[model samples]
Target chain A: MAFDIFHRHKLTISGTQAQALEMARLRLIWVGMLMMMGYLAIILRMGDLCLLHHKSTAMLMGSGAPAETERPLRASIVDRNGNILAVSLRMASVYADARMVHDPAKLAQELAALLPKQNEADLFKRLSSGKAFVWIQRFITPKQEYAINALGDPAIHFQEEQRRIYPDANLAAQVVGYTDVDSNGIAGIEKFFNKRLAAGGKPLRLTLDVRVQHIMRQDLAAAIKTFHALDGTGLVMDVNTGQIIAMVSLPDFDPNHIGEATNNEKFNRATLADYEMGSTFKTFSIAAGLNSGKVHLSSVFDASHPLHIDQFYIHDFDAKDRPLTIPEIYIYSSNIGTAKMAESLGPDYIRDFYQKLGFMQQAPIEVPERATPLYPSPWREVNTMTAAFGHGIAVSPLHLVRAASAIVNGGILLKPTLVMPDNPDVPPQGTRVISAATSEKMRRLLELVVASGTGAYAWVKGYDVGGKTGTADKNKNGRYENHANISSFLGVFPIWHPRYVVLALLDDPQGTKATHGFSTGGYTAAPVVGDVIARMGPMYGIKPRMYITRDSIEKSMKPYLKEYKEGQALASVSTDH
Target chain B: MRKSTLLWLILTVFCGIALFHTSQKVHDERARLAALNASIAHEKQSIRVLGAEWAYLNNPRRLEMLAKTYLHMAPLSAAQFIRIDDIPLRAAPAAAPAPQTEKIAVKKISPEIQPRKIVALERPVTMKTRKPAPPRIFKKRAAPDGGTATARNFRDVMKSLRLGVE
Candidate 1:
């Protein structure tokens, strides 16, 4: 029985081994099928890549459009009338990678043909320096860019850069100013408000009217050409608001090409050049005397001869050599009479008046280029005498305009500004420089200067123009040069209630035949003011009173100037020099 | 394997398929959003460029020159304007004519239908008798042509306007 059981067990073991072998054979077939499926997927993928669209993605990427970039925008600058003066344009600049450049000389020669400003030798030196990257040219024209792109140089690249553009060109160059290549403000209102311009949002709106600026510039250039002067400047200020309407300085440069402009072309003479603005100072001195309550329009000052003070003799440009009333002194522009008036008022009172007028310090204007007034260190009688007639003290034409504004615009001294105020209707409560009564009197006096005095040439038929004429000898090395003088006219129009003060200056005007060998303010600058008023008055909406006469203004000052009229008529008939 | 294990396995496969499908959909949406952002940036850049061009085109110097050449107009002057109060009411429009109506044929009407004479209406006697002043003289800014025509064609229209005004 044991032998039989052993044989059965052997048979069972063989049966189990044969069943396990069958299961292993079936599993091997399944594994073979899985391997075959994997191979099928790999072959299908290779076929799809080869037959359908090989390198489709690589081509799409290689010919892709330029990578998107965001460049910071700079703000625009506009005039008071919303005329665009300066703008920033997004421009493409070409640059090069020296490491990637294979043939520096050839590439540089090709680039030089496109960028005419850069020579081939310089470009080759830059490209061969082996630097990582270098700028080739900035703000290239579209045609130049297209030409450069056709070169197909792998190392050459283009980048969008911000470029400052002045659309008005040299219209208001000194005021609107110019910017550097890096889009930074460097002069004029641009320099004054540089950071605000860089942090770009809204445009910088100035208080300038392009039309008015054009008119002023046209008239000023004509006057300069006519008078044969070196240069000229003209400014129009809204006396009530202290807003500069138009400012023009001759020999101005185009802000777009600031690098090519000469230093003289870039100099802003209106606010930077200091001159001893001759008899225009008499207007201030008379106002000072009137405001001090010690002198009246009818008060008389002795001017029998040239008064010798220490080493100086104070005399008129054309001496009357007689005792004269204050009105006569102003109309005749008598230096001796004004000196006597200044002496009577004392140096303290005169200096105080000048300080109140902002003549002792820098002009309070919205420009970076400002000049401090040159005055005597210590107040003396001789300084007061010369300063009374606009000598011994130097101030810019802008300073004279501001001081004249205070004297004419109801005694309120306001800071002149390039930016318009938020509320122009609400009168700015400025520091008081004179009484309203005194201002009224000063208006009449200035009108006298225009009606029958030195500024007779500045008289517009129906605009009630009032002004003073100043012919200042050009000082050279502390000596007054003969035949070279600054002829300036300070004018206030519709003088009954003054609204605008215009200053026209001709620097070193030569004598002309038409002017009869006179290069004085009345001949050169006063006529310019008149022409400007005649044109701009109608444009500015100032009505023309067809029938207004000198009698209308004379009625107001009849109480004080009854005796001075006869003498003024004789003196003003041929008043040009 | 038990039937419950097979059911659990089937449920897990379904969840895996749903998550995979959701992830694919999210990838497609992200790509579309990226394309939209890029297009928006391009549009903004174009807008900035257009704005700059518009400003350049509208520069005052260029506009003034255009006005001078095409519009034939001068800048407004103070003399050309008057106080609003000076513009008197326009004569009450001169009593507009009555609207027309269909009428019987005059030639065919009978003898009893003879036309009656027109009567004029009388205004109120209390009205003032002030005569209107003549219009102020200003240089007419008549367009040379109808604005789209060339400069040489402007004179005929201007002459006709002058004749019409007269």
Candidate 2:
């Protein structure tokens, strides 16, 4: 066989050459083993990262994530038409770490220049206090915040805060109320629904109409100024729904500046203060009599002289001094006649009637500001006589308006609400306080007052306006003041089908030239109610009937007023006397 | 065996490049998503501020003051409102025949009456021609053909309503 170099395995070389080749193969095997071990270690580490350590690695990579936007701390308060009454806005509050601040005096001087409202001395004192942190100023404007930040002081920092803002300001102040610096609601509907507002969802909708509220305020303020009266209160309510459309109590305070408000300005007279509602209570008295079947429109009462009960004398402002029918009594606002009517109804029956009208307790409304009515506790006979003409018992104007609404709104006693119901199509459930027939009769009587009697100034020709005049001598320290009286008019328009009940009251109104030096409800407040009705009529699109004359009113009221013609003859005779 | 090793090395390089590219694209998309979310939050905040400002500007008291200063208008009075039934009906064309004798007398008095009536009729024709021009301009700006058809349909509906009223 020929031994060739190509077939090395078959040909054997001896000694050192063969041994060297074997050593080279052994070293190559060792290096290959080391490379395989390194690859295996890399595979094991990758498996560990993919299985158990992935979450930790991802978190480490995402450590610099962006922050989410924050929502308002409190929800907004809107009117019935979605007009914003109250809202919360984000603001920057400036604070300083006293320990980090190197030049407190220089920073204070700089901050005072930026914030004109903040005093330099006060800022320096707070900044130099050895405390670690101190608030320099709260709720700084955007302009001031930008200027202060330009100072570039690392010691000063900004804290995000929420501040409540009342955009409508003094327009709906009492109803929307104000909040404390810590964003806690302190009064009115804010305090009433604080938890719901703080939870932050949709805006809280109220039953107030901004347009109607403005109208009432403007008219009431004009009347107050003209008569030189103290603070006045006005309200408008839907009789059918018992929703307060507008409420104004002046001297109203701007909710934005709650710190500067006086105690009297904070007092909500519409729902909180109680007053003897004066002759406006006669509407309830007659309604009570009619509902009880004890009094008819044709029933007659003697107003020939002042009634003597205990030591009190109940005298009519314009005494007829003759027998007057129920319609005549209401139209003329005869205190003697109403007292006689209440005398027939008796004390227990009158008290029960008033209690049924929610007059014995606080007015049930959404606001926490309310007052319990003050009536005679013993329910004596004299109390019945006095309460009939709205003299002894005292109730808030809201209570009077709610009760008056029931009397004219088909006799259904509905709870008054400042918050609008969620479903408007569904009418609120109400308790029937009187028969619809009695309400109809009462409507006719109210119309008669505007057509021919003391509430004549409240009449709008086409609106068929009807109401009563009340001039109550406000009781002061248990004694009724002589010249200081609350003159008010409770008005309902289109009395044939009553829609809205508007009341305007002036506290201690003095007589003016425009009112013929007469500060009674008819002279002072009735025209305001009439003007408000006239302006509001076109807004509500209520059709005005040019054909609804006084003749037509008298004809419709003929059946109830059988003695009306006779009473008219007697009235003319008394005027002549 | 060397050829197979070379092919395996090329496949590993391609796989590594693809993995790196995919991860880089995912990282860029995540950053973009965060930016978009931040912008959306900013827009929502701006909308809230604008709504508050709108309510403040549209306050009835402020509007009334502005109207008093700038506008020549008065509050609507009760006398200004009238029932639709109270509107007097248009004089029938048949009543024109009753005026024919007076027209003949006027014609004898002055030939100028004929030209005056012609001018009055021409005024309405000019107005009618001018009315369609504005809608045509609007159509040119909106869509080529669809806007014209819709505008014509709107005009036809308006014309029919006017005829019904007449």
- Tens digits of lDDT, candidate 1, A1-577: 5565334455555577767766877898999999999999999987887577667733443323334345456788888977778877777899998899999999998899889899999999999989988999989987998999999999999988888878678889998888888988899988988888988778888898888888788889998898789999999998998889999999899888998888898888889989899988998999999999999988889888889989887767676767888888887788899999999997688888899999999998888988889999888879888899898999988899988999999899988988977776887767999999999988988898787778888888768899999988899999989779989999998898898999999999886788777889988899888878877887777886545566665555556553445333435523433
Q: Which of the numbered candidates is closest to the native, going by highest lDDT? A: 2
Worst 10 residues of 1 chain B by lDDT: B118-127
- Candidate 1, residues B1-166, lDDT tens digits: the string is 9999999999999999998999788677667766776797678657666655665566556665445544445654334444444443323212344333113233333334233322212212222333322323334344444444234456754554444331
Where is model 2 more than 4 Å wrong at Cα?
Answer: A1-71, A558-577, B1-22, B95-166
Interface RMSD of 2: 3.2
Candidate 1: residue A465 Cα off by (Å) = 1.6
Query: RMSDs, each prediction?
Result: 13.0, 12.4
Q: Roughly what TM-score does model 2 have, to 2 decimal places? A: 0.80
Location of the lowest summed lDDT over 10 successive residues in candidate 1 chain A: A57-66
**In candidate 1, which residue ranges exceed 4 Å CA deviation?**
A1-71, A422-429, A554-570, A573-577, B1-166
lDDT of 1: 0.80
Q: Model 1: which residue pairs collide?
A: B144-B154
- The Cα RMSD in angstroms, rounded to one decimal, for candidate 1 relative to the true structure is 13.0
In candidate 2, what are the lDDT values of residues A287-339, reduced to their tens digit?
Answer: 99999998998899989999887898888777777998898788778889988
